[model samples]
Target: MAEKNLLEAFLKAEELEIQGKEFYLDASEKAHIPSVKDLFKQLAEAEEFHRIKIREIYQTFQAKKNIPAYVTKISQKQISPVFDPKEIEKVASVVTDLAALEEALRLEEKSIQYYQSLSDKSKDLKVKRFLLALIQEEWGHYLSIFDTMEFLRDPSSWYTFKEHWGLEGV
Candidate 1:
């Protein structure tokens, strides 16, 4: 992995947030299910928030040329996931549940890796905490996407089981 200064890293993260927001907006427009459409719209808003957060951080700390102390240390855990390209086929529209879920999964997985990397690299305690918060948020997003995929795969069974287990109000 290539090393980047904090400003550069945050700038890259901001760009990613913009892309994520755009993708979510497009997905919302193309979604067939009302619930999925709402989900995408909500995620788009969240991405916008993430973008602003990163931008603020970058602007505040861009003058500092300090490389994080942890940057030189070897990472103990492999944070990146290996996904098959064939599993992420491009779609003109995210109208189908399966297609949209696949794309959402991909995005969440990528975000998880990105935020985790930032968390791992940050030496400042406050910065590390903020990055870890983002990581946790991304992990939650990934889990939600995974759950939605499972529900979409077998709605009847999943929904029924959830309702039976008193977990239907989400």
Candidate 2:
């Protein structure tokens, strides 16, 4: 029964990843800024990678009738900031970009919740670990979107705060 539940969860996760990838691709196509477009493209790739991993795990579990040992190390590619300070002024007019970022945030939050819920219910250590890794990745995506949103809202302030820059003489 537990195995069945795990298999069902894997299927659901794969569907979620596919949805995320499609959304990111659409967002990338609609993005006005090159940096934002690149970010969305990277996110789409990450979602595709997740889908592939989930499919592989599902096949392995189905064949072995046991959860395979998951590696503790989850590799994530570093994503650069979504805007350059010089081009930040141009982003002020990008309301659609902001809207897309908001939607991305919602999607990532949903994925994190779904993975966390499944991880909480899982009895198998390997299954739990795998879900936890996914949760971490989704959380990273959420944070990246959030930071980009903040940058879009006020690039100068975001940079000042993020960089911990203080006025030494004023």
Candidate 3:
């Protein structure tokens, strides 16, 4: 049934939220730099909020018709390793703080793409709205990271208007 399919997709989103929370919390434990550690913590908190939102959506769907909610795809393949610690290792080799920030922005941008696709796949309006909000939050987080890193690299460049905004800024 179409409803079943919708429930499955909604459940998939819930699972993703849980996975993200776990990853962020674990990374927070391992991060040495205070800023890095705080970033992880902030991400984890966001995930937690997403998880709650997903559950609320799940409950809403169930309440609509008393239909049981179930997800068929518990897939790692759908999950992008966008937040992998390996990103930092590789970025560190090529550059320092500014480059590091750029790399994270890239990752977050990629995640926004994934979330957008996933959001499009959902039939429920509430679910779609939640996904859109998540995407926006990711954009904000990525911008914050980029701006902070820019500030760190050049204190004089605080709020310095660039010749052009990158994709993230736009």
Candidate 4:
């Protein structure tokens, strides 16, 4: 019964990753800004990686009837801040960009919540750890999208706050 549940969770996770990858790919193609496009591409790659890893784990679990020990080592790529403060002026207030960012944020949040719930229900420590790792990656994606939204809304304020530059002198 537990194995069935685990397998179901794995299938759901893979599906979510696939959806995220497709959305990001489309968003990347539609993005006008180079930085935004690159960021979306990076996200799409990460989602693809997660989908692959989930499939591998699912196959291993089916054959072995247990979570793999190496599952803990599965990690997503760490994405650095892509938006440059200098390029802030170049980022026009495009409604589609903001709308896409909002949608991306929603997708990431859903993934995080799903993983967290799955982790809580998991009995195996390795499976729990794997879900936790996925949750963290989704959170990273969420934060990246959120930061991009903030930058789009008000680049100067976002840059000032992100860079920790004092505004007292002004």
Query: Relative to the true structure, how large is the alpha-carbon lDDT of every model?
Result: 0.67, 0.86, 0.59, 0.84
Instruction: List the candidate numbers ranked by TM-score, top first.
Output: 2, 4, 1, 3
Single out the weakest 10-residue window by summed lDDT for candidate 4: 67-76
Instruction: Kindly indicate the candidate among 2 and 3 with the higher TM-score.
Output: 2
Q: Which candidate would rank higher by TM-score, 1 or 4?
A: 4
Superposition error at 86 for model 4 (Å)? 5.3
Provide the clash count, candidate 3: 0
Q: Kindly report the root-mean-square deviation of model 3 from the true structure over all alpha carbons.
A: 10.0
Cα lDDT for residue 148, model 2?
87
lDDT of 3 by residue, 1-170 (tens): 26677667668766766766676677667654455556757766776776676677677777775323343221212221123333433333333444444655665676678779877886655556666877877766677666556545543444335433345745
Better of 2 and 4 by lDDT: 2
Distance from true location, Cα of 82 in model 2, Å: 4.6
Top TM-score prediction, candidate number: 2
Off by over 4 Å in 2: 65-68
Which pairs clash in the backbone of model 4?
Answer: none
In model 1, which regions exceed 4 Å deviation?
Answer: 1-4, 63-95, 165-170
For candidate 4, the lDDT comes to 0.84
Clashes of each: 0, 0, 0, 0
Residue-by-residue lDDT tens digits, candidate 1, 12-128: 888888988898899888875655666777778778887877776676676554423322212122222222223233322333856876888798788779878877877776677
All candidates in order of lDDT, best leading: 2, 4, 1, 3
lDDT of 4 by residue, 1-170 (tens): 28888888899999999999999999999987777888899899999999998998899788876664635445646875578666776677567888898999999989999999999998778888888888888888898888888888888888789789885767
Q: What's the TM for model 1?
A: 0.73
Better of 1 and 2 by TM-score: 2
